[model samples]
Target: MEDNIKDSKQLISEIQSQYTRLSKGQKLIAQYILNNYDKVAFMTACKLGETVGVSESTVVRFANTLGYSGYPKLQSALQELIKNKLTTVQRVEMSDDFSDENVILNKVLRSDMDNIRDTLDGIDNEAFQDAVSKILKAKKIHILGVRTSFVVAQYLGFYLGIILDNVHVVRMDMGDAFEQIVRVGEDDVVIAFSFPRYSKKAYQLVKYAKEKGASIISITDSLFAPIASVADNTLLVNNSMASFVDSLVPAMSVANALAVSVGMKEKDDIKDYFDDLERMWEKYGVYE
Candidate 1:
């Protein structure tokens, strides 16, 4: 229990580090817990085992592998950690009555604002600046995101392309992101966004980009996220402001900051890029 509260990342890393020592059943339980932490936090041993395709005794053994006295104790620690880290409104909305429209609106707004504040406090300035520098200096920038995160990535790619040359946003259903990432090199960078219930494809893209020598910047809910672990630099974003859904306000702000920082860093280059864009717009009659 003490170990679980120390650091979520360290807890998972320790388990992963010793994964080879775990029995087959324990490995199944470990994988389930790691992937469904939020769910396990609220589930009983029976329910957890049912989901993991293991028996209740196997689930208890898995907890013991983590040095817990029993499964209940492990669940308690997970509940406490999640309760402390997740925004209050997230829990409240899950069980509270939202019959009143005004009440719901106020709650959502307040929760989102709190999430933004928490995210700002959690951000590491040096790491953030380093990521920005990587993107700014790269010969090409690739942004990958899926599901809801796709919207944020698209917005970032659009603004970045306006301010920087060689910016590409990978759209959903686009064939083989890994194949696309093969085009990136040591002179390029990849910025990836993924949150809880992370996109496996996004993770693969990050891995492929890294293997190809492209620097990576990840924006995720915690350092425990797969993408965060692989990134050259990571920015933590708090998205648990709502129950079972992640808020995008904080991520959008982070994206905006990255774009503005890169723009300021290459002010002269951006000026020339926009000048060329203006000439093209005039020739194509894009706008009056």
Candidate 2:
């Protein structure tokens, strides 16, 4: 089947072109969507109808009228539209509306759990095994992420470096970040973390790495995320929000899974490495 129409411009054009043909109820829904698409993206079909003074089926029909399979498909398209387009202020505003009016802590905690659940549920096992395989086989593995994502990259890279050899992290602070991966080639693997409001430079680095024949593994919020489009393996992680900041719990979980999986794949090598590290730690009295 053809994919859902995801481009906001195209979605808007479809709605506008079909406006006159829409029944009164759908027109009402259309008008609301046109006026508040970003906000509407977070809403369920039932809630959207409640806001537009229509029935849930009416909202579903409006989505079908726009050539979407159903309301969820249409809403997903809407989300794709604003994922990177919204600024921090716009995100805060939209998140405020989606979250509960009371019990702030519960809402935030629940949202993080939901994100982790959804991320786990939607994972592609094939892609995951392939990611582990690539990491294990790569002559060198380069990790790249920037801004908020840098922390995740560091966490993964630090642990992976402990269990694996020839691991590199690209960080702007470390003079000439790109130079770290300049030698990447067909035998290399580039695992990048990118979320909403993605880092443009990270995309450039990964693109360059891909062009150099390195395999790309992208852990991001959506498959259409910039790096994912060029990635050899795409791990879709959920980073939903109930507050101003986007949740990173799910993303971190994915990174942890990858590190552990890779370590398991190279069990003997990692065990030896850890045993040596333990000796060094004991000798240096690194622990209390």
Candidate 3:
């Protein structure tokens, strides 16, 4: 009944506090839900029963034991917990009522907006400023991502190139990524973007960059992600709401902020670079 016992960890602790009171099947259900809260948020009572190796009726009873009126109510609470913790895309997928397209669309949009708001609230300004500083100091900055994240990497690279010097957006085939990573050195930095169903190539790039003494700044889904293991600095993004789509609005916002911070740090350098480019354009009629 503690107000603090709202999340999965607290929920698990609550179960533990009452562990001695639970029946055999209810105990199994509790253990399964505690261990797999994320999975349980998206599963039905029958499916959860199968997962916990308990009868469907036992699943309902387990929910009742947890103070829910029924399984559906329990599921709703679990879903809400996940909604609070996961990304928009992740929350949509886990949600039970996906039959209506309009409902799903509304939920997705709302969730995405919530994600952006939450990210802004949780972002460490000092850490972000440090990342900007590292990027500004690097001789070369490589932006690397594969698959769906490639689009984000490319966009960041394009915008950064306009405002900073020596920004390389590397999104060729994975085979080429290895060659490119090898060219990076201690004086460089690699800003990597990857999410769930994360790319092995991205992981390799992180490893390769680390081995070559380049600083790695990663934007990924969670602290548990493989990319986090090697990152000198990490920005955690939530993308867990929906199904397969990786909603990138929040990631894009973060990238733009970083770019703006870097530009502001090197305002004079950026202005001079743009001035030189404009002169070259005018002299060569490049725009025409």
Model 2 lDDT tens row, 1-288: 234434454887878888999999999998999999989988889999999899999998888777777887787778778778888888777765545557787777898998899888889889999999999899999998888898999999999998887898888798877778888999999999999888888889999999999999999988778899899989999886555687889989999999999888789997888898899999999999
**For candidate 3, what is the TM-score?**
0.70
Candidate 1 vs candidate 2: the lDDT winner is: 2
Which model, 2 or 3, shows the larger lDDT? 2
List the global CA lDDT of all models: 0.80, 0.86, 0.78
Q: List model 3 lDDT by residue over 139-220, tens digit each.
A: 9999988888888899899989988769988867645777776789999999999876667888988888999999999997
For candidate 3, the per-residue lDDT at 219 reads 91
Off by over 4 Å in 2: 1-10, 44-47, 55-57, 64-73, 98-102
Supply candidate 1's per-residue lDDT for 138: 88
Ranking by lDDT: 2, 1, 3
- Pairs of colliding residues, candidate 2: none
| Model 2 clashing-pair count | 0
Distance from true position, residue 197, model 1, in Å? Answer: 1.4
My TM-score estimates for the predictions, one after another, are 0.67, 0.86, 0.70
lDDT per residue as tens, model 1, 100-215: 77687786778699879978987899999899888878899999888889999999999998887689998777786666777889899999998756778888889888988999
Model 2 accuracy (lDDT, Cα): 0.86
